[model samples]
Target: MSDQPVNLVSVNTAPERAKKVIGTVIENVKDKYTIVHAGNSATIDGVKPLLLSIQPPPGILFCASMWTPEEQAEIQQIARETIPGIRTHAIPTGLQVQVGPDGVIKYLMERIDDIMKV
Candidate 1:
């Protein structure tokens, strides 16, 4: 699959409807992401920074391209501002772990083998 990012138009002003259009483009996939381009190749929308997960189907063998690197820090900052010592950890993937203090990501541990080193 290609790593090129897809552009996400605003839902209201887009040439096509959000759910209706993007839906048809990705129906039966049963995944949050859309394959904007196809040909042994796929591209995803930029709104990926807003995505929460890319879960695997029961019969599927794998899932890839989960968290993005951009510091979509608003969500994190909100958590810190609203709460105290609220440690949040999300293992969005089996090997990858995210630990948040309040809301800011303290670190991302992608390999248990490297945990001690980290």
Candidate 2:
């Protein structure tokens, strides 16, 4: 089997516009991406299960949260502390980030077209 890095896109609490952008990304990359719906919960308890449920797991985890700034920080902190090994990114709600297999961000953008370009 090929060992290409798995791309993860987590939608924590997306607004309407953010949802559309996420949808576009998913539609474009679904064949090679793992999508996680995190809803409004940001705690480890809430996110861990979803991560575990993904068969074979992912080499990279991208968490996108549309919550308030305070909540966003809390979520990012929890994810970093709880999940080890794999790469993790706590992206803002309206923005998107493409993470490479080496745990580095390849691209970050607010527009769907820019995200798709990655």
Specify the highest-lDDT model's number.
Answer: 2
Candidate of highest TM-score: 2
Per-residue alpha-carbon lDDT of candidate 1 for residues 68-87, written as tens digits (9 for 90 to 100): 32222332333234333322
- Across 14-82, the per-residue lDDT of candidate 2 in tens digits comes to 344344544555555556544432333334357666566565554444455445566656655555555
| TM-score, prediction 1 | 0.19
Clashing pairs in 1: none
Estimate every model's Cα lDDT from 0 to 1. 0.25, 0.46
| Clash pairs detected, candidate 2 | none
Q: Give the local distance difference test score of model 2.
A: 0.46
Candidate 2: regions farther than 4 A off = 5-9, 14-20, 26-45, 93-118
Stretches of candidate 1 exceeding 4 Å from the true structure:
1-65, 90-118
